[model samples]
Every structure is written in structure tokens, then in C-alpha cells.
Target chain A: MNRLYHYPLSPFSRKVRLSLAEKRIEVELVEERFWEQDADFLRRNPAGKVPVLKMGNRLMAESSAICEYLEETHPTPSLLPSDADGRYEVRRLVAWFDDKFNSEVTNKLMGERVFRKIMGTGYPDSANVKAGSKAIKYHLDYMHWLLDQRRWLAGNELSLADFAAAAHLSCLDYVSDVDWNRSVIVKDWYAKIKSRPAFRSILADQISGFPQPSHYSDLDF
Target chain B: MNRLYHYPLSPFSRKVRLSLAEKRIEVELVEERFWEQDADFLRRNPAGKVPVLKMGNRLMAESSAICEYLEETHPTPSLLPSDADGRYEVRRLVAWFDDKFNSEVTNKLMGERVFRKIMGTGYPDSANVKAGSKAIKYHLDYMHWLLDQRRWLAGNELSLADFAAAAHLSCLDYVSDVDWNRSVIVKDWYAKIKSRPAFRSILADQISGFPQPSHYSDLDF
Candidate 1:
């Protein structure tokens, strides 16, 4: 069986899990405290990041690359659009979330509130938390602006963009960092994606130090 | 004709330029001081990053996404491999260079030594430069290890992975940061890539403040 070595709170790992579940690919989930730098895990992935998929003879790292591999290997319910332009939009948004939003928001809020505690790094820097809080409002507004024009984050159809976004937002929501009431359209967008069967595994994720909020798994939320 | 909004020093932008040149796509280069956050550049790309490709009616951001777009729309001289596994390895290495290697090496050395002065940020941080210099030897050795086994960075064929690695190395080479004497195989690999016609524009790049080192444009060094 395929195995995905991932951390529960890692948005990148969650992105891969959502893609796998969305595609109905069967994989045993193995939680990895990747920062420990275990010799075995390092052997599995030299990059030393999570969401490393062990499939048959191949060990894959890099969430985007692994996601693309899944897309190519299993083309049943395609996450990418048919046209080049549409696919570009999807990949662009994926980068936006994984790179830009990640550095500004997720690394700020989650890195401060959750990771420091879990990893035993140090105390949470309230400054970064404040910045992350402020930054998230902007991101939420951006999402609202996007959702106002299109059905999903990228376009009319659900794409990897949606999964990439939902992955981050859901993790933030797990810690109650997200203000769901910020925008009705964004909330509605979340409602649509959150209720999907692919979200079940993520919703059930239990991190040792951090407890999930009640509304996180709520379809009505 | 297409146009690319790029900063000469940005590895991401350089990566796109290489893909365009290799694929024989005609794109007018527009140098963007993206960090200034100009309203017009932001309008072109909300992310406010360089190497925004204006192709026909569409304006695109994110270099990796743009490269994939170019590859998809123009597939003749494919930078990506044919098989799914080969393609995955290519993307993985591309991400490796762009993400891990970038944060560890490129951003540290180039960001401190070059961008700080150019952007008027402050004096170069010696600690970071030291760390970057130290990290680069390991990266070159890793490259040497890979090249010893395979012809190119990713595999037997030239790939976007090569372009990605070259883009970062070239920028570092501009500041005389790359120790070519460290690895003969890696130096040979650079020699082969540096001699390509696609590298001409990159070779000719003249940043406002930083003069190009003699070795930067040299096909034989």
C-alpha cells in the first residue's frame, strides 16, 4: 500500500492529502515529526520535508510535484483544467497560497501559535501573531474578491487551486485563527469545499499539543 | 509579441527567460523593480512579483507556473520529460532548487551581497553571507554527485531543473560567489549550459549598480 508521511498541522502535507483523497487514491497516513531529522526519514526524503509519498518503488517529495504526479497518473477526476490558461491560473494560485500567503500568514499565525509549542522551539511572538492576524484579513478580503467573480478560487470549476487554499484555511481554522464571518461569499465557498468527502481525513486529524475547534468540522460552519 | 516583466537578478525570472529562449518563444523583456510595489506592476500582477508573462490576452505570475504554461502551450522543444516519473523528478528538482536551495543559498548570498545594496536595504549581513557561502559548497557537491550519475541535473536529458539550478548559480556567479574550483563535474555542467544560445540574454544582463564579473558571461572559465 502507498504511505504518506505527513504532519497533521502542515498545510503542504494537507494539500497532498486532500488531493489524494479527492482522487480516491488509497494511502496509509503516517504522521512524521520531520524536524527531528531521523536517519530513516532523511533516507526517505533528502529534502527533509513532509508529505513524502512512498508508492510502490518510488519515494516522492515536494508537494506540488507529488500532486502533479497524482494528476498525471490518475486522471479520473482531474484537478487541473483542460485549457492551458485555466491550468496556469490553478498553478499560479497554488503558488500564491504555498509561497506568498504561506510566508505572510500561515508561518506567522501557525508557526507562532502551534509550531513553536509543538516543536518546543520557544514562546509565541505576539508581534508575528498580530501581523498574521492583520495579514489574514487582507487574504480573506482577497478571497472574497476572487470568490465574488468566480465560483471557486481559480475559476468556475473546482481545481487544485481550491484544494491548495482550503488546505491552508482549514489548518488555520483548526486553531480558530480564521474569521469565518469575514465574508459571506468566502464562507459559502468554504462550505462547498469543506463538506466534500476528501475533507474527512483532515477534519479528523488530531495533533498532540493542539486541539481542533468545534466549528472546524462543521458543515454548517 | 509577448512581453516578460522580470528583474535580472531574480532566479525565478531567469528560469522563465531560459525556458522562453530554449523554446524559441519571442518575448520582449521588461525589467520590473517589483519590490517598490508600483501600482501598475501590482495591476499586472496582484502578487507584485517579477517575471509576469504577458502572452496574448493573459497576464501571468509565478515563474514555475509560467514555465509550465509555456511548456503546455508550446510542446515542441519540451523542457519536461516524456514519462510521468521523469516529469515528477524534474518538477521535484525544480522545487528543490527554487525552494530549499534558494532559501538556504541564493537568498542568503545574493539577497545580502547584491539585493541589499541594489534595493538600498542596508549593509550586507556577514553571518548570512558566511552561511550562504558555506551552504553553497554542499549544494555544488550535491550537484556534482547528481551529475556524476546522470548527464543533466534531473536525468539524461536537459530539463527545467537545469535551467532552475543555472538561474540561481548564474546570479551568484555575478557576484563571484560560486567557487567553480570546488567541483569539476559541476563546473563542466555549468560550462555546457553557459555555452547555450538560450544563455545569451542572461549573459548580457547588466544590473544598474552591479557590474557583471568577467567569469559571469565567459563560456570558458
Candidate 2:
């Protein structure tokens, strides 16, 4: 059987999980503390990161690459648009969340508040938390602008862009870092995506030491 | 006419530039000081990053997205493999260079040595430079291992993966951060890639404050 080695709160791992679920591809999920940099894990993925998918003899590392590979191999219920222009928009938004949003909001808030404690790094840095808090509002507003313009993050059809964004936002939400009241449109978008069957496993995710936030799994929330 | 707003020392920009050139797409290059975050540049890319491409009416941001779009639109002299597994390896290595290598090596060394002075951030942090310098040896070794197995970084065929790795290495090479002497196989790979006609503009690049290294433009080197 195919297996996925992932961390509960890792947005990149979560992105791949959403893709796998949306495609209805069954895979055994194994929790991995990637930061510890175990030799076995390093052998599986030299990058020493989470969300390594083992399909048959193939082991894949990068989340975006894995997602695109999935799309190429299993084209059913396509997570990308048909046209090149549409695909470009989807990929652009995916990078925005995975790269920019990740560095600005997720890394600061989650990195300090959750991972530091979990990894035994140290106490949370309040300055990074403050900056992350301020940065998220702008991101929410930007999401509101996009959601206002289209039904989904990239376009009318729900795509990997939505998954990419929801992955990060959901992780932040797990730590109660996201403000649902910031933008109604953005909140509505999250609620819509959060209710999907694909999101069930994510909602059920439990990270030890930090109990899941009450609203994190709430569909109505 | 197509136009690209880019920065000379930006690896992301160079990746896109290499793709455009390889695909034989004619584009006017416009140097954008994205760090300044000009209202106009931010309007082009809200992520406030370099390497924004304008092709006719469509404005594109994100290097990987733009490169993929270019591959799809211009299939002649393709930059990606024809098969799914081949494509997966290429994308994986592309991410390996663009994300992992950028964070571990490029951002630390180039960000400290060149960008700090150019952006007026502060003096170079010796700690980061030391870390980057140390980290690059392992990266070069990794490249040697990969090159020993396959003719190119990803496979026998040339792909965007080569461009992505070269883009970062070239940027670091600008500041003479790369120790080309560390790995002969990796050096051979660079020499082969550097000799490509598509690399002409990059080899000709001359940063105002930092003179191009004597060996930078020399194909024989």
C-alpha cells in the first residue's frame, strides 16, 4: 500500500494530504517528527522534511511536485484548470501561500507559538508573533479581494490553490492563530473548503501537547 | 512585446530569464528594485517579489509558475521531460534548488554578502555566512552524487531543473561564494550548462557595485 509520512501541523504535508483525499487515493498515514532529522527519515527524504509519499517503489519529497505529479497521473477530478492561463493562476496562488504566506504568517506565528514548544526550542518570540499577527490581516484582506472576485482562491473551480491556502490557514487555526472575523468572504471561503470530505482527516488530526482548537474542527465555524 | 521586471542578482528572476531565453521568447528586460516595494511593482505582484513577467495583457508572477506556463505554451525545445515520472523528477529537483537550496545557501550567503550591501540591510552576519559556507559543501556533494548517476541534475535530458539549480549557483557565483573547486563532476555540469547559448545574457551580467568575477563569463572556466 502507498504510505505518507507527514507531520500534523506541517502546511506542506497538509497540502499533499488534501490532494490525496480529494483524488480518493488511499494511503497509510504515518506521523513523522521531521525536524528531529532521523537517519531513516533522511534516507527516505534527503531534504529532511515531512510529507514524503511512498507509492509503489517511488518516494516523492516536494509537496508541489507531488501534487502536480498526482494531477498528471490521476487526471480525474482535476485539481488544476485545463487551460495554460488558468493553470498559471492556480500555480501562482499556490506559491503565494506556500512561499510568501508561509514565511510571513505561518512561520512566525506557528513557528514561534507551536513548533518551538513542541521541538523544545524555546519560548515563543513575541515580536515575531506580533509581526505575524499584523501580516495575517493583510493576507486575509488579500484573500477577501480574491474571494470577492472569484468563487475560489484561483478561480470558480476549487483547485490546489485553495488546498495550498487552506493548508496554511488550517495549521494556523489549529493553534488558534487565525482570526475568522477578519474577513467575512475569506471566512466563508474557509468554511466552504473546511466542510469538504477531503478535509475530514485534517480535522481529526491531533498534535500531542497542544490539543486541537475547539473551532478548528467545527464545520459551522 | 513581452517584458520581464527583474533584478540581476535575484535567482528567481534569473530562473525566469533562463526559461524565457531557452524557449526563444523575446522579452524586454526591466530591472525592478523590488525591495523598495514600489506601489507600481506591488500592483504587478502583491507578493512584492522580483521576476514579474508581462506577456501581452497577462501579468505573471512566481518563477516556477511562469516557467511551467512557458513550457506549456512553447513546447518546441521543451524544458520538461515528456513522461510523467521524468517530469516528476525534474519538478522535484526544481523545488530542491528553488526552495531548499535558496533558503539554506543562497539566502544566507548572497543575502549576507551582496544583498546586505545592496539593500543596505546591515553588515554581513558572520554566523550566517559561516553556516551557508558550510552548508554549500554538502549541497555540492549532493550535486556530485546526482551528477554521477544522471547526465543532468534530474536526468539525461536537460530540463528546468538544470536552470533552477544553475540560477541559484550563478547568483552565488556573482559574489564568488560558490567553491567550484569542491566537486569536479559538479564543475563539469556547470561548465556544460554555462556554455549554452541561452546563458549568454547571464554571463554578460554586470552588477554596478560588484564587478563580474574574472572567471564568471569565461566558458572555459
Best-matching candidate per lDDT: 2
- lDDT string for model 2 (A1-221, tens) is 99999999999999999999999999999999999999999999999998999999999999999999999999989999999999999999999999999999999999999999989999999999999999999999999999999999999999999999999999999989888998989999999999999999999999889998789999988
Residue-pair clashes per prediction, in order, are 0, 0
All models, DockQ values? Answer: 0.95, 0.93
Clashing pairs in 1: none
Candidate 1 stretches greater than 4 Å from native: none
How high is the DockQ of candidate 1? Answer: 0.95
* After superposition, candidate 2 runs with Cα above 4 Å error: none
Local distance difference test values of all predictions, in order: 0.94, 0.95
How is the predicted docking of candidate 2 categorized under the CAPRI scheme? Answer: high
Residue A24's C-alpha lDDT in candidate 1? 96
Query: What C-alpha RMSD separates each model from the true structure?
Result: 0.9, 0.7
Candidate 2, residues B48-76: lDDT per residue as tens digits?
A: 99899999999999999999999999988
Lowest lDDT 10-residue stretch of candidate 1 chain A: A205-214
TM-scores for all candidates? 0.99, 0.99
